[model samples]
Target: MAAVKLSGKSILALLLMYVVLIFVLQMWVGPRDRWAGYSVLTPLVAAALLPFRRTLLVGAFTLLAITGSYGFGVTGLSVGARFVVIMATALSFGISLIVCRVRLEREERVKRLMVARDRLSLLSAASSRVGGTLDVTSTARELAEVAALRFADSVTVDLFEPVLRGEDPQDLPADGCVTLRRAAHVTAVAATGRETTALRANSAGAGQNREVHVPARWLDPGRPAATRVLEGGEIGASGLPMPLPSAGTGAEGWVTAIAVPLTAGKATLGLAVFARGPGRAPFDADDLMLAEEIAMRAGVCVDNARRYTRERETSLTLQQSLLPDRPPEQQAADVATRYIPAGSQAGVGGDWFDVIPLSGARVALVVGDVVGHGVQASATMGRLRSAVRTLADIDLPPDELLTHLDDIVVKLSAESLGDHGTTPRGDIGATCLYAVYDPVSRDCTLASAGHPVPALRTPDGVCEFVDLPPGPPLGLGGLPFESVTLSLPEDSLIALYSDGLVESRHRDIDAGFKELKQVLAQHAGALEATCDNTLKVLVDDPPQDDVAVLLACTRALDASQVAVWEFARDPAVVSQAREAVSRQLSRWGLEGAVLTTELVVSELVTNAIRYGSGPVQLRLIRQKTLICEVSDGCNTAPHLRRARTYDEGGRGLFIIANVTERWGTRQSRRGKTIWTEQALAP
Candidate 1:
C-alpha cells in the first residue's frame, strides 16, 4: 500500500495534536507508566500519515516533551515511565525510517522495470523494421529512423566507405583513423502533443551515402568519447558539438550523445550515434545498452547488404567488360544500342546484345538473355555472347549459328551438372535472337531461340514484328532452329531486343509488345534517340530485368558497285573475267584496284576451273573493300600447300593468298564459294 501524504495544514495540525497529547499525558495522566508511553502514539501516527522526514521531526518533538516533563517536574513522572517514553519515541523513528527506505527501493525497482520494457520494445522495433532490405543505404536509413522514433532525438549511422559499396570494411587501426561515409541521419524534435511528433528528416553530408573522404581526425571532431569508441573501445557517452545532418533545422546542438560501434562478431563495420538535445533526458546506462543491441542488429544487416553489393558489383563489372559499349563499325548496317541492368533488390540479370561484323560485308545482330539473375547468369551471358561471335566468324547461317550456340549451352549445362550437381536454371537455359544482315544481298536471315521476334521498320516508316517461328531456347537439346530470310529495303530498321524490354510485372507480355510497337511507330529520330525512346516508353524505371536493345539500319551495295560473270568449266574464261573486272572497276571509279583485283580474279577463277566441277561464277563487289568471289559446283575442299621448286599448280592459291587482304572458302549446298577481299583506298 502507498504511504499517505498529508497537506501542509494537516501536518501542522498533527504536530499540534502531538503537543496537546503530550500535555495531557504529562499533566492529567501524571506519573503513570501507561500514560507516559503515550508519547509513542504521536510519532507512530505521524509515521503512518506523514512522510519520513515529517515522522522523524514529530518523533524528536515527542522525545523533547518527554524530557521536559521529567526534568522540569511539571507532572511528576516515574523513572520507569520516563524510560518508556524515551525508548518508545526512539523505536517509532527507526521503524518509520526503515519502512520509508523499503518503499523508496521498491519504487526505484518498478521504474527500472518500466525502462527495461521500453528498451525491449525499441529493440523489437529495430529488428522488425530496420534492415528490411539488402540495399546498403536503405538498411542504414531504416536503422536511423527506427532508433530516432523511440530512443533518441537524433540518430546518425556512419559506415566505412567501402561498406557502402558492398565491400568488406577494414578493421579499425591502432591509431583509429579512417574515413567514413554518412549513410543516414534522422532527427525528431519533441513536440507538445506526444501523438503528433514532428520528425525532421536529414541526409548525411551533402547527399545521401556520399563518400566524402576527409582527414581521419574529423571523424570524432574533438569528441573524445566518440574517438575512443571508434578505436575499438566500448560504447562511450559524451557532450560535444557534433555536426547536424545537412538538412537538419530547429535544433542546433546536442546535450548528450552515445556512440556505439556497428559490429558483427569482432569486425567493426561502422558507428551509430544517438543524441538528445536540451530539455530531453540524457542517455543513461539503459539507453546505451539498447543502442548497442540495435547497432549489432544493424551491423549484421549492413554486412549482408555489403556482401550482396560486392557480389553485384563483381557481376556488373564482369558484365560491363563482357558487353560491348558500342558496336564495332561495320559496312553492312548503322548500329546503336542501350543496356540497363536490373534493380538492386532483384539482383543482376543476364541481358546482352551485340553487332558482330561478318565476312562479305555482312553484320550479325544478336540479343540474348540467360534464364536467371546474378553472377552466374551474367557469366553465362558472356560465354554465350562470345560463342555467337566465334560461330559468326565462320559465316554460319542464322539457324546454324543458333544450333551451335545451343550445343554450347548444353555443354555448359552438363559442365555445371558435373561441377555443382545442378545449374541455376535447372539446365542453364537462355533465349537468343540472331539475325545476319547481308548488305550485298539486302537480305536479313534471322532465327530465334525462344526469344522475342524483331520489330522491323521499313524505309516508309511502317513498323511491325516479323511473325517468324521461334525455336526452343538454348540448353534444350535436339531442337531444330529454323531461319527466315527476308529481303530488307535499303535503310530498313530492325530492332532486336531481349525479353526484358517487352516484359514487366505490371503488364502482360503482349501488352508490352503492343506498347513497344506503338512507341517505335510514333517516334522518329536518330538511331540513338530511337533506342532511348523505346526504353522510355516501354520499360519501367529500374527495370524488372536486364534490358538490352539493338537498333540497326541496313544499307545495300549498288548494282554499279557489283560485277558478276558465269562461264563453262574452262581456263579461257580466266582472261575474259580479268578483262571484264577491269572494265567494272573503271566504271566504279576503282581503276586503282585493277592490278590486285585481276591477279586475285585470275588465281581464284583458275583454281575453281582446274579442281572444281560444272560452271564457274565470278563476282566483284565494291564497298569498303573490293571482294572477288568464285563459286563452283565442287564438293572437294582445297588446301594451300607450299609449291615444290618445280610445282605448277599450288602457286595459284599461294599467289592469291599473298595478294589479298583476307581470303576464305564458304561451303554451300550447291558446292562452295571461295572469296577474297582487297582493301580499297579511303
Candidate 2:
C-alpha cells in the first residue's frame, strides 16, 4: 500500500515485504475459512501500488501468490467457493489500478503549475526592485535577494564591477532564507567559468553544497567572456559569477557555483551568483532563467546613466563655445555688449552682432539671427557671422552684402541638400541689418534683408523707425536692395534688432514695434543704459528664438562754434592750408584744440586742391566733439595707405587716422565728401 507514495526502489522492496506478509498470513490462517476475504483484499493490495507501476507489477505477482492460497483453500472446499473468490479478486485489482494512475497524473500537473507560479513571482519582485533605486549597487543587491528566494538554496552576489552600485556602497539585506555575500568575484568566474558555489558547514563551516562556477557568457554566447574580468584582479571581464567549488573548507567538493553575466550589450557590467548545499539538488532551469532577467534589467539602467552623463557634458561645452569671450573693440564710438544664450539645458541659437571698420573712416554695424537651435544652429551662426564681417569690410554696400549672403545660403542648400538622403530646401534663412555710418559727415546709410527697420532717435529724443518697405529674406527671392540714406543728427541714436525682439507669438509686427517705441521712450537716457533696459523690458525670459541688437548714437559736433578763416589761393598751398584752418578755429572760440582741427583740415583740403581741378569747401562742426569735413567735386573715393616716408601727400589719411576718433567719405550725386571727427575736451 505504501508503494504508491514511494520511489521505484522503495516500491520494489515493499513488494518483497508484501510477499513475505502474504506467505505468513496464508500459512497461519485456515485457508477454507478466510479464502473469500483474502481474495477480495488481493485487488486492494494491487491498487495500493499502482502509482509506482514497475514496483506495482512485482507487488501484483506477490499478491497473486497470496491469492493462490485463497484458491487453494477454495479448491479444498466446494466448486462454488473457488469460483466466487477468484472472480472477485480479479475485478478488485482492475478497478484499483485505474484509480491510482488517475490520481498520480493529477498530482504531477499541479506540481508543474506551482513551479511556474514561483518563477513568475520572482520576476515580478525583481522588476519592483529596479524602480526603487537609481544606483546600480543597491539594485544589484536587491536583484540577488530575489534570485536566492526563487531559485537557489542560497544566493551569493559577487559583483565584479557593479554598475548599479550607488555612491554610498551599502550592504543589501538578504532575501528570506537567503545568505548574502557581496564580493568582487568576477575574476574567479572568468578563469573558472562558474556562477555559484556551495560550502560545507563543517569543511568551510559544515553542511554546505558543492560550488558551481558559471561563466557570464553562458547566457549570450555572442558576448566575449574573457574580457569581463575586474581590473587589478585575476577576474575576467568587469564582473562574473562563480559557484563554490565544493561543500567543504578544503578544495575537494562537488560543483556548486553558477555564474550569471550582468551586461547591457557587449561589455560585462557585473555578475550574480547562486549556490546550493553539496548534498542538496542542483539548480533547476528556473533558477538560470531568473538570473538572466535580473542581469538584463540592470544592464539597461546602467546604459541610461552613462548616456545621460555624456549628453550633459556635450551640451555644456557647446553653449560655452558659442558665446563671445570678450566685447568687440570700439573703432569709432564707445561700445557695450551682452549676450544671453537660450536658458534651456540643451543650447543657444545663432544670434550675433559685430562692428567692423571699413576704409575711408566708415564703420559697418551688423546684427543677424540664424534659424534653429543646438549644435547645427551654433555652427551656422559662426559661419554667417564671419561672412558678414568679411563682406562688410570689403566695402560692399548693405544690399550687395545681403545678396552675397543669400548666394551663400543657396549654395549651402545645394551642397547640403539630400546629404543625409533628404532634400531640405528652404530650411535655412537669416535675418540681418547692415548700417554704414560716417562720423565725419553725420550720415547713416542702411540696407535691410528681410530684417527689422532700425529706430532712429534725434538728439532732442524724437524716436521713429526708418520707414522703408521690407525686402525679401535672404535665400528667398533674389531682389535688388535699395539703400536708404538718413541725415544723422549729432548725438542721435540708431537701434537695430533682430525680429525676435519685435515679433512675439502673441502679437503682430505692428504691436511689437509699438512696444519697442514705448520702451525707448521710457529708457532713453544713455546709449548703453537704454539698450539694456529696453531689452530687459522686452524680454523678461529667454527668447524663444535668437535675438540680436546693435545700437549707435552720434556725438554731434557744433558747427556754429567751429572757427572760420578765409585765405587767398597761393602757389605754395601747404602753409596756406595750415594757416587758414588754424586762424579759423581761433576765431570760432576753439583755440585750445585748434592744432588737431587745423592739421586734419589742412591735409584734407590740400589733397582735394592738389588732386583735382575743381573748387573745394572746408567746414568744421562741434557737437559732443569737433569734426572737419572737406568737399570736392571729384567723385573718386580716397585711399588710405601706409605712406612711404618720403611721400608727403600720402601721409594725410595716415595722420588723420591717428588724430580723430573716426573719419569717412560719402559719395553723393554731386561729388564726394571727406571728413574727420575728434572728441571734445571734457
Candidate 3:
C-alpha cells in the first residue's frame, strides 16, 4: 500500500491526543507503570509527518509533560521505577531524532531527481525545435524562445559576425575584444505585469545596430573560470550591471545571468545568455549545465543553416549574371521579356531567353529550358545560349540551327557520361524554341526541339498558338526538326516562352495555354505592358518552375519602302537593272548612295545572268539601312575570295563588300537571295 502523508496540523493533533492519553493512563494505572514511557510515541509521529524543527519541539514538549506527571505524584512508586521510566524516555527521544534525519535525507534526494527529470525534458524539447530549420536566424530565435520559456526569465543569442555569414569563425579579436551580433532576444513578463525591454548595443566601428563589443576583461582567457567555459565549452555565470539604464525600471528585479558558449566541433559559433529576475531563483550548477546542452544542440543547427544560405545566394548570383540585362533594340521588332526563378526549395533552374539580332534586319527570339535545377543547370543554359548565338551569326535556317545545337548537346552528354560512366545530371537534356522575324517581309520562321509552341496575337487582339512541328528534345540525337513560316501583319505580337509559364503540378499545359491566350487578348497596349500583365496572370507566386517570357511586336516595312524587278538571263538586262536601281534611289532621295548603288546593282545582275539560272529577280528595301538583293533559281552559296592580277571577275563582289556595311546570302523556298546593306544617308 502507498504511504499516506499527514499534514502538520494532523501531526500536531495526533501528538496532543497522545499526551492526553498518557496522562489518562498514568491516572488509571500509575506514573511508575511500565506503559508510562510510551509517551515517546508522540514525538515519533511528529518526526514522520512534520519538519525536523517542529519534530524536535514536539519531543521536548512530550518530555516535559512526562516530568510534570511524575512530579505531581499522580502515581506512588519507588525510585527504581522512576529511573526505569526516565531511561526509556531518553532512549525513545534519541530514536525520534534519528527518524527525523532519515526522513529529511530521503525528501532531499527525491527533490533532486525531480529537478533532473524536468531539465532533461526541456533539453529534449529544445533539440526537436531548434534543428527543424536550415535558417540561421530562425534557429537562433527558436533557441531563445525555448530557453526563455523553460530555463530563465530572459534569453539572448549572439553569434560571431563571420559565423553568422557562413564564414569560418575567426580567432578572438586581436585586441582581446570580441564582436557579436544579437540574433534573437526574448524576455519574460515581470512581476509587475509589464514586459521588459532587452539591452541593445552596437559594436565599435562596426556600425551595425544589433552587434555589440564585449571587452577583454569580461571574457579574459587567463581567468580560470573564463578559460573553463570558453576553451572547455562549459557554462559560466556573471552579474550584469544594468546594461540598459532606461529599461532598468521594468527589469529592476533582474540580477544574475548564465553564459554558455555555442560550440560545434572545435569552433565556437557564439554565445547564449540566460538571465534570472530577482523574484525568480538564481541559476544553480544544474541550470548552467542544461543551458550548455541547449546551446550545443543549437550551434550545430545554426552552422548548417548558414552554409545552406551562402550556397543559395551564390547559385542565384551566378544565374542572374548569365541572363541578359535587356533585350537588344532592333528595327525588326520591339522586344520585352520576363524571367522568374522557381521557389527556394527548387533552387535556381535552367530556364533562359534571349533576343539575338541577326543579319538583314532580322531578330532571333529564343526560349530554352534545361531539365534540372541549381548551378549545373544554370551553367548548361549559359553554354547553350552561347552556342545559339554563335550558330545564329552564321545565319543558319531555324531548322538547321537546331540541328547543330542538338549535335552540341549530344556531344556534351557523351563527354559527361565518359567521365563518370553515367550521364551527369542537369547537363544533358533541354528544350528550345528558335524564331526569326524579318520586318521587311513581316514573316516569322520558327522551329522547335521538344519545346512548347509560341503564341501569336494579331493587332486586333486575336491570340492563337502556332502549330509548328515538335522535334525530340536536345541530346536525343537522330530526330529531324522542321521549320514553319507564317506572315504576321504589321504590329502583330509574338510570344515565346518556356514550359514553366504554361505547365505546373496543378495546371495542365492546355489550361495554361488557354490562360496565356486569354491574358494576351485582354491586354492591348505596348509590348512591355503586355509582358507585365502576362506574367501577373499566368505565373503564380514563387512559381513551381523557372519561367521565361519573351514578347515581340513585328514592324513590317511599307510597300513604298520596297521595290522588286524581274529580269531574263540576258546581258542587256544588266543595264536595265542599273537604270531601275538608280531611278529607285533617286525617287527615295538617296542621291548620295546612287553611284555606289548602281555599280553594286550592275555587278550583282551581271553575275546572276552569267553564272545563275534564268528568271532572275532583284529587290531594293529602304529601312534602317539601304538593302540591295538579287535572287535566282540557284542553290549554291556565293563565297568571297581574293583575285590575282589577271582576275577581273573576283573584284566585283570584293568592291561591293567594301562599299556595303554587311553582305550575306539566305536560302529561300525557291532558291537563294544574295543581299547587301549600305548605310543610309543621314
Candidate 4:
C-alpha cells in the first residue's frame, strides 16, 4: 500500500491544535501538570511537515518552550508538574527521531525502484537495437550507439582480429600484452560537442574506418579491474589511468568507466567499455550489472553473425571452384560469359555456363541452374556439368544430350530418396539449355529442359527469342525433349542464359525477355559488350538468384575453305582419296602440309575400305586447325591399340594418331566419321 501523505493545510492545523492544547492545559491545570505530556504531539506533527533534519530542530524548539514555561513560573506548578514537563520534552525528541528515520527509509526505497526501472528500459532497448543484422560491423556499431545513448556518455567496442574475421578466439597472451581492433566508437553529442582529436588521429592513417589498432596491457588478467573483467568474463570498474586507445586523450573527461567482456559460450570475442564524463555519478553496482547484461546479449548476436559470414564465404568458394575458369575456344563461334553469385544473406546459388568444343567445327553453348542454394546445389551443378561435357564429347545431339542429363537427375533424386527415406522438394530439380552451332552447315540446333529460350540477334541488329519446346525440368522421369534447328546468318549473335536474368518478383518472364531484346538491339557491337550491357540493363540490384549469361557470335566457313568427295566400296579407292587430299591442300596454299596430309588420308581410307562397308566419303576444312574426315557406311568405330613388333594388322589407326595432333571418331546417321586435326603452319 502507498504511504498516505499529509497536506500542508492539515499539518498546520495539527500543529496549532497541539499548541492550543498546551495553552489550555497550562491555564486549566498548572503548566507542569501531568496532562502536559500531551504536548509531545507537537514534535510528532512537525515530523510530517518537515524533513528529518528540520523535524529535529522543531522538536528542540518545542522542548525549550516547555522548560522556559516551568522555569519562569508562568503558571503555579508542583515538583510533579515539573517532572511531567521534562518527561514530555524528552519523549517528543525521541519520537521525532523515529519518525525521521522511517521517512528517510521510504524515500531511499523509491529511489531504488526508479533505478531498477531505468535499467530494465536499457536492457529492453539493447535487445531491440543490437543483433538486428547478421553483419558484424553493423551489429557492433549499433551496440555502441545504444550504450552511449542510454547507459553512458561515451562507448567503445573493440574486437580481436580473428573474431572480426569470423574465427574462434585464441588464448590470451602470457606476457600480458593484447592486440585489439577498434570496431565502434560513439559519444553523446551534448557531451563531446565535436569529434575527439584522439579518434581523428587514430583514424587518420587507418585504411578502413573501423579497423584502427590499439595495443594495451590493460587487457591482461593482473593489470587492473577492467582487465580482470575481460579475463574472467565479468564486469569491473576503472578510473582514467587504464589504457583505452579508443578513448585516447578524451579519457581526461571520463570520471568513471566500466568494462564488460563480450563472451559467447566458452570464447571471449571482445570487450565493451562504457564511460561517464565529469559531473555524472560514477557507475554503481547496479550499473555494472546492467552493462554486463547488455554485453552478454550483444556477444551472442555478434557470434551468430560471425558464424553466418563464415558459412556464406565457404559456400561462395565452393561454387566458384565448381564453375569453369574460362570458356573453350572453338572455330564456329567467339564466346563471352558472365557469372554473378547471389548476396551473402541469400547464400550461393547453382548457376553455371560452359562452352564445349565439339567435332566437325561445332561449338556447344550451355547454361544451367540448380533449384536451391549452398554447397549441395553447387556440388550438383558440378556433377551435371561434367556429365554434359562427357556426353558432348561423344557427339550426342542437343536433344539427346538433355535426355541423358534428365536420366542422371532422376537417378540422383532416387538415390537421395533411398538415402534419406523421403522425397526432396525442388532439391534435385534443375533447368538447362543446350545449343550446338555448326559453322559448316550455318545452322544451330537447340533444346531446353524447363529452361528459358535463348535470344538471337541478326547481323542487322534485330533480336528475337527462339521458339523451342520446353521439356520437363531435370529429375522428372518419362519426359520427351525435342530439338529445334534454325539457320543463322554469318555474324549472327546467340545468347544463352539462366532464368535469373529474365525473371524477378516484379517482372514476369515475358517482360524480362522484352527488356533483354531491347538491350541486345541497343548494344550489338561485340560479344563481350552485349553480355555486359545485358546484365547492366537487366540487373539493377543484387539478384535474388544466381545469374549466368553466355553470348556467342556465329561465323560460317565459305565454300572455298572446304572440300568433299565420295568414293565407291572398292579397296582400290584408297589411292584416289590421297590424291584428292593432296590436290586440295595445294590449292589452299597448304603445300607444306601436303606430305603429312597424304599419309594421314592414305591410312584412314585404307582402314575404312578394309574393315568398313560401302559408300565411303572424305572431307577437309580449313579453320584454326586443318581437319580431315573419313566416313563409311558401317556403324563400327576403329580403336587404337599398341601393335606387337611382329604384327602389322592393327597399326593403321596408331599411325594416324602419331602423324596428327589428335584424332577421334563420332557416330553419324549413316555410319561413323573418323577425323584428325593437324596444327596449321605458322
- What are the clash counts of all predictions, listed in order? 0, 69, 1, 1
Candidate 3 lDDT by residue in tens digits, 27-81: 6764347557578677787778888887887888777777676656555777776
Q: Residues 311-357, candidate 1, lDDT per residue (tens digit)?
A: 99998998999999778988899998988998887788889999897
TM-score of 4: 0.78
lDDT of 4 by residue, 172-281 (tens): 66553466666776655443545344333322333223443333344432344433222112222222123343443254556667777677887777767787765467
Arrange candidates, best TM-score first.
1, 4, 3, 2
Name the better of 1 and 4 by TM-score: 1
Best by TM-score: 1
| Candidate 3 clash pair list | 253-278
Q: Decide which is better by TM-score, 2 or 4.
A: 4
The TM-scores, one per candidate, come to 0.80, 0.49, 0.77, 0.78
Q: What 10-residue stretch in candidate 2 is worst by lDDT?
A: 184-193
Worst 10 residues of 4 by lDDT: 231-240
Q: Model 1 scores what on Cα lDDT?
A: 0.78
**RMSD of candidate 2 to the true fold?**
13.8
